[model samples]
Target: MIHFNQVSVVYADARTPALDGVDLTVPEGELCLLVGPSGAGKSTLLGAVSGLVPHFTGGTLHGTVTVDGRDTRTHRPRELADLVGTVGQDPLAHFVTDTVEDELAYGMESLGIAPDTMRRRVEETLDLLGLADLRHRPLSTLSGGQQQRVAIGSVLTPHPKVLVLDEPTSALDPAAAEEVLSVLQRLVHDLGTTVLLAEHRLERVVQYADTVVLLPGRGRPPVIGSPAEVMAVSPVHPPVVGLGRAAGWSPLPLSVRDARRRASELRARLVGEPPASRAAEAAEPVAEPVATVTSLGVLRGTVPALDGVTLGLSRGEVVALMGRNGAGKSTLLRTLVGLHKPTSGRVTVGGVVPHRTPATELTRRVGLVPQDPRDLLYATTVRGECANADVDAGAAPGTCRDLVLRLLPGIDDDVHPRDLSEGQRLVLALAVVLTARPPLLLLDEPTRGLDYAAKARLVTVVRELAEQGHTTVLATHDVELAAELADRVVILADGEVVADGPTADVVTSSPAFAPQVAKVLHPQPWLTVHQVERALGAAS
Candidate 1:
């Protein structure tokens, strides 16, 4: 029901069109995925459907974008609000009401929907989004995932025919991401609604998508086809496809279930045991395990944040802490550094209790990179910021400057930290943390809002640090990142340790935690593209 005919969009100050000579169409009741690396103009397409392209985000537009037979050039966002519901990446940005119930009913009330209908729709939406328990809670009290569902529920309650979501699962943990994706799946199946979503994490959601719209890259045609069809050949692919590629499988699998059925025959034909490359590589770690937590219980204000938490950190190891939102993953990390004084826990780094030590001493031993490094950055320039870092960070002015320029080549020495793109700013903020050269580093969602190239830059930099003997512990929902960088895996759920072990062990345990390659293995858990390659290479 939406069509873009040779659509080209240019922002008010832009030199080139955001969408250049693009022609696309989506039929009614279709759930289409808009996948690409960041800044691939997926958002531009969503804007046209929601009438935000020409109306809200003012820009010079060319060609026709027709939605439901009405030209978007003529229709404003409000005029099409009844036809489309738009949920953005930043859930906190879209909230219009203070309370959950009021937010759900806000749209219907604006559309002059009757009181009874509004109430019914609100109740139905709360039930559908599984927000009934939190119906009376204030919007501010909800977590990022909860707020996101509420945002979707508010729009869906109005009975919009289509939903346009930008990075819906970016901020969620595995379980929460699945919860939202499941709700979307149900909406499409039961309600016959259209879905167009743009996201960086494709492995988790691509299987559910009926159609895939691979955006034109820096220089390429946008590929459109069935999920399997496009995924089989797309350059921007889930790691499982890489496994399928290396394995030379026919009609590649989108999920483990499909891969398992096909892989058994292949496994039977395989020869001897694979080389112990990964195990050998792991054994060579030069740095010692200075921190170890055994049978630890993490508690926060009467609620168990981490129950029976146990893990050890080797100086050269990069362990990815994985779990869904409200899973107590972040709590476990904070407790490690004594940010949240655990009621019943022991975190020791080099035989020194983490929480019992002075806050200043903790900085000397462990460095934390918060989710929004913005909270930590206050200086006016790249030069001034690092100078102000806590001395334990070991950040002298020269050391910080060199670190900044090396990580982000184009980062202006004089530009305000806030002016940089999300990824650039993160790297710059991290530069400040690195100057101190602490032995243990903790990062919380370090890759949010980054473009594809930028993410690679970060992974490379972090890998270098790990190679140099820094214990890196990053808390993130990015499974691919986890698979690519982490040496170990731990999963937290509702302030309790549900899974902990080597990357393969934990991933194998949680189906939701499995990466694309492991999906090919079906029952076996493989967390990264490298692991898939090794499995296929060994099997070959």
Candidate 2:
């Protein structure tokens, strides 16, 4: 029961409309997925539903957006609070209270609901999102995934008729993501809530979508249809869709199980050909360790975030740190950059303890791109940010700008850093970190908002850095990226290293960690669609 009639949104000084002449309708009780490349007006469309587009964002709206018989043009976000709930990409920006339980009840309290009713809804939401155990925990102390759940719960407690989420599962681990999606499914089935969401990790949510909306960038009209119909022509898609296209499968499958059911003959055709080995190319003689952790232990509010974890990174090595939510992946990266002091054991970067080194000295030797790219960005314009980055890293003026162009071509130099899309912001942050030419680079969730084209650019830049004798360690939940770029995979669980080995060994052996290509071509050892395409091309 959401309708956009001839909707067009243009920011104050933007040359083109973020959304142009868009007409879309989401029927009641249906979950519609908005899919597109970065900067495709997906976030703008979501904002329109909750009355945040022109109202809070200071933009001009050309047409009316109505939700449940209420025109967003007439009702502000606060007026539509009972009928709409919106969660933006950054969850930390949404929280008003410090603790999980208080955040969940805050919305209902604002709505002036009875205290008893608010309490009942709070308990129900806590159980629905699996946040019962973390009810008392401070929001700042929780993991990214945990904070995401709390953000969602705070909105869900209002029992709104519509839920609009931007990348709801982006920060969640596989299992946690599944739980969140399952909750949405229940809401659509039992509660008759209208759910509209945008997610880059299409593999996790495409199969569950009732309708798919494709917004080709550059002010193109939106395409609306079933998942298969849209994915057949969509430029950005998951590995399963790519595999389906490569093999000429009719009606592309959306999930791994569907692809596996149709993969028998294709697997047979590639029987004798093995995928090319990325690990072999990366197996050069190991140089001196760039960073070393010996029995590292870190405590977060009495919880052991990292427990006796020992790891090493050699010069020119590219390692990926992977694990479930709250499994110590982010903690390890922070430890290397000296953000978290180890409660026990020691960490040394460039042969000196990271915690003991001065901030300026440590930044020269090691640069970190945090999970939230906004942490590294504060300047108003893109050019200003790059200039500041050059000054901070002691590099030439144009060094950071050149890297930004390489990572994301055609980005406007005069645009505000906050106005850029999530992916573009990430690319800018990466460029800022790379300006110093640090011996070691750390990226946490680097590809969270990137499209396929942008991700390919990142892959090339990361590989080039390794070739120049730089050590790179990235913490990620994107399995497909790790499969394509990582020389080695290190998995942590329960604050300890559970598995550490070559990329092939670590990813293919675990079902949860395997990419879509590996899942479809199991026992064949192929990890990426590109690898399989290359092998088949060579054999033919």
Candidate 3:
């Protein structure tokens, strides 16, 4: 259904081609998964399928790309609208309407479909994506994950033969991610729709793929194979794969069920060795709470975003704030940064009320990297953003730049911030916030676009910050990150706190929240590959 004939793409000023000699064919009615590190050509390749490559991005396409017998070079995105549907990394950029229902119908309306057909498809999409209850909500009022589902539903309503999605489930919770993937699986199996998606969270989608395409960056040619074949050698993989590698499994497991089946002997080896006690180490006495929320209640246009939520953050601790979409996790983070004032109770950071404090004064004590990294970036070039961050944070001249290089190496200083990939843009935003070295830091979906290596660098940076007496609160759906980095996990539901405890106690107990490693080594209290590796090493 999709064919790439010796295709290569090079941006106007790019020194190297984004994609080089990428010759491959995706069979009809199959789900193809794209995997690679950041700066890879995954996004560029996806754009090529929908005719947005050279047409809209101003790149030079060296070869041919055809979708469903239509050449992308000749048929622009608008001309191929009926044959292809695309949902990019950022959902905010895809909406043409203010509300969910209107947004879903906009694509079909643009295609000149009959009103009755459009309405039927719209209703069907809302139900399929669990967006029926949110049909009336404004796009701006919805949560990040909610907006993502709406974006996907909009594309699905068009009923295109091919769907191209980039990080489609990055913002969704575990259950929501499963539902979205299941819908895609149904589209592939029942409707004969061809699905091609690039996701950094391999743990969520690897098992769902019918084929795997690995775009190893740094000018290496792409590798195509089955999920197991690709994951065995792919540098970027989920913790389950990492665990499988550590334990010398003959055939690496893509899903937790498969891994659990092969974990009997390894579990026996870990009989007496408990997982390393990160929670116990973090329980040592610490400084007073850098941020405090007492019965915090917040309303977003008549909806209770946060209700009667009381929490405390001690200095030098990392807390993972987790829950389903629209569960008030983002609201709590925003409340800490003073973006939203409490409708009822109080919020304080470093002894000062965040909402009452001046913007300049508040930034020194608390900084927030929002879900949309573009919100914090305004400068034209990467260097300019770093310079501005230094000025705003009153830090050393090279502090922010150094952080960016550490988080993602080899980023061009002169490149426009708009030209960077989603993961690259997120790294810049995080560097900008880290320059302040605030007593308390808040991150909303910090690992949204980051690959395994970049995420590892981030884990290191955050841990180093904790050692210096800084508090970090991450509102995220990345279960693996919580397992690997967080000292504590706090879960919220319906604007109220539901679960709050150590990471092992919180994540290992819930099937929906457990990481790949924990699920494989269940009943043993292991949360990460590193934990299992340590236990094995000690036993040996």
Q: Over the stretch 1-540, how does candidate 2's per-residue lDDT look in tens digits? A: 999999999998787899999999999999999999888889999999999988999889999999999999999998999999999888999999999999999999999999999999999998888899989999998888788889999999989999999999888877788899999999999999999999989989999999999999788999999999999989988999999888889989899999999999889989988888885655552668899999999998799999999998999898999998889999899989898888999999998888888998899789999888999899999999999999988788899999999888878899998999888899999999999889999999898878777888999988888988898998988898899999999999989999999899999999999998999989888899988787778878
Rank candidates, lDDT, best first. 3, 2, 1
TM-score of 2: 0.97
lDDT of each: 0.74, 0.91, 0.93
- Name the Cα RMSD for model 2: 1.4
Residue 360 miss distance in model 1 (angstroms): 7.4
TM-score of each model, paired residue for residue: 0.82, 0.97, 0.98
Compare candidates 2 and 3 on lDDT and give the better one: 3
Single out the weakest 10-residue window by summed lDDT for candidate 3: 278-287
**Candidate 1, residues 253-304: lDDT per residue as tens digits?**
7766676677775455433433233345453445488588777776555456
Alpha-carbon shift of residue 446 in model 3 (angstroms): 0.3
**Per-residue lDDT of 364-483 in model 3, one digit per residue for the tens?**
899999999999999999999999999988898999999999999978899899999999999999999999898888999999989999999999999888878888999999999999
Model 1 has an lDDT value of 0.74
